[model samples]
Target: MGSISDETVEENADAPTYVPSLPVPNVQELVKEDPLQVPDRYVRDQDDILQVNDMSWLSSEIPIIDLSLLSKGDKEELNKLDLACKEWGFFQVVNHGVAKKVLQDMKDATTEFFELPLEEKNKYAMPPDDIQGYGHAYVVSEDQTLDWSDALILVVYPAQYRKLKFWPSTPKGYKDIIEAYSKGVKDVGVELLRSFSTIMGMDQDALLGLHEELVQALRVNYYPECSRPDQVLGISPHSDTSTITILMQEHDKHGLQIKHNGGWVPVKPIPDALVVNVGDVIEILSNGKYKSIEHRAVTNESKERISYASFLVPRDDVEIEPLDHLVDSQSTQKMYKKVVYGEYLRSSMKRRMEGKAHTQMAKVET
Candidate 1:
């Protein structure tokens, strides 16, 4: 774990000393008030159904890779990455060369942003129509009663137009710092995609070519200390919708969990390491060669948690379907349609807002 510095101090001196105690709304009341109506799907018993301790069977072999030691051009490292992608769908990367200071700065800035007073933070609050912002859960209704968390979701892509209008003005240097970090993460993502291409037995540039104009976003999530950590979840079980997600976690706080084999396993944090995972788009493009694993976040009774997830999505105009080379007369290659990335993203957002399970892609014409 990385050493804690003074930057971890709470940004808002006048902010609530603790998460406010709000009454948990009933399911019917939640549905009536929330536009997302997420709580409607889950049974709202006071029982701690979300808690699970039988994680012994969970995969303990999360791959820890050292990119600097591996030959970037070597076929062996690429092969190893590919195998990890197919089997684990998640891995920890070290020595990937994004400065440790930059990562820490981003984390510090995020914690400070979320610490802002409710009124000040609300200035950049997500619009009722947009499901991204400084709130507990945008897609769900306030009455739905989420466990406990606040997040800042930033959309930085197309370098032109964004489909969803969710951007927050922050402290003086916040934007510049975050944008630089985003660009750095994007470059790393490109490198990983190139490695994936090699593993798929395609030209190194093939995947990069297809993603020349990828749309990317950063989700800065903060899960505050919960009064009833065992009774609820920080984030419900779900799979990511992007091609891939690279996450930087706070030291000492253990909130991230992943479903592997059959149980949930805590992903212990490693200082300066980036947690990389496959997403739904990669599963489709790889024709199921790579799976998108289900994961969730859990709250702690005492310690607050923070995480930064950089999602690499395909450009709105990119055609999403299995690669031609992966298909053959003997292979069942026609599983999904050639839909535009933008359409797929919109559909995913709607499903998420509804608090439904992630939707699988179906074969259909654009």
Candidate 2:
């Protein structure tokens, strides 16, 4: 764990107190009111909405990694994981230790919270200049194109960082489920990070040891069915700034897609499997040996889709850059500039989600 320092304090002070987003119509409520007529702001230009119907371009199914095997020190599974990160930047993990009961309870709680009366759900609405609570995120302008989704986003780790008031209480066991769920997913993330460090020929704990307080945030997204699904997006294409992100999709619904081979590949939801992806921070740390893939959510015409995404990030004070050993390799160079994690976050939260723009900001000009 990293020790506190004066530099950390200064960096935190400069970071925005809160990442605010513009208020957007409650997409769930709006769809209920008029599912057939999408607001002009919600409709994107034809060019903005990429057609993903060309299934032939999709590569083979996203690789699946067995956490159970990895935990047992199975070398073959470890190699598969390395290949998954390098080639696909995404994978599904089966037998991930998150309990089935915990997953179900949280999924139920999320659905119940979203089904609450609009007024009840709005009780925890995103405040005037804060991204926490419920509503759209990264909606920075009045004219900004809107996504057809609503989300409850909250920092769920390190105890003190959690905004309990924004946590849903309407669902009787919501808070407890969140606590249980976060702990389980965090365990999974830590194990994965350790495995990553091992893959890099470093001590298993080397990477995670950079921060005394790693941050874990949860975003529960509710994408309502849309009449014109082809014209709207559930979420814009973007790469996460986290070290890694884990997502639990509703078992029977499919909307997640990753950009591969210059085409969009749909991710089919598997029962009891959690999808994991490499984030920009991982790419930066690995000196681009691993990649962070661009992915987006598409709106569904016949049914609503819900997903739970847990982002695991380094604490604000940690300095992030290509690890020395990775850069020292003959074939590699320092591709990204070193920056405090908090400052990187500040830059990311300031911009709307688009492709991999935020990650590119860290690249060094050779």
> Model 2, which residues run further than 4 Å from truth?
1-17, 51-53, 56-60
Off by over 4 Å in 1: 1-53, 56-60, 69-71, 136-147, 162-170, 331-333, 353-356, 363-366
Ten-residue region with minimum lDDT total, candidate 1: 14-23
Predicted model with the maximum lDDT: 2
lDDT of each: 0.66, 0.85
Steric clash pairs (candidate 1): 34-141, 337-363
Q: Give me the displacement of residue 145 in model 1, in angstroms.
A: 6.3
How many times do residue backbones clash in model 1?
2
Best by TM-score: 2
Candidate 1 residue-wise lDDT, 136-238, digit = tens: 4434344553544566676666444332223444554666567667877887888887777777778877887887576778787777665456665677667
TM-score of 1: 0.80
Candidate 1 CA-lDDT value: 0.66
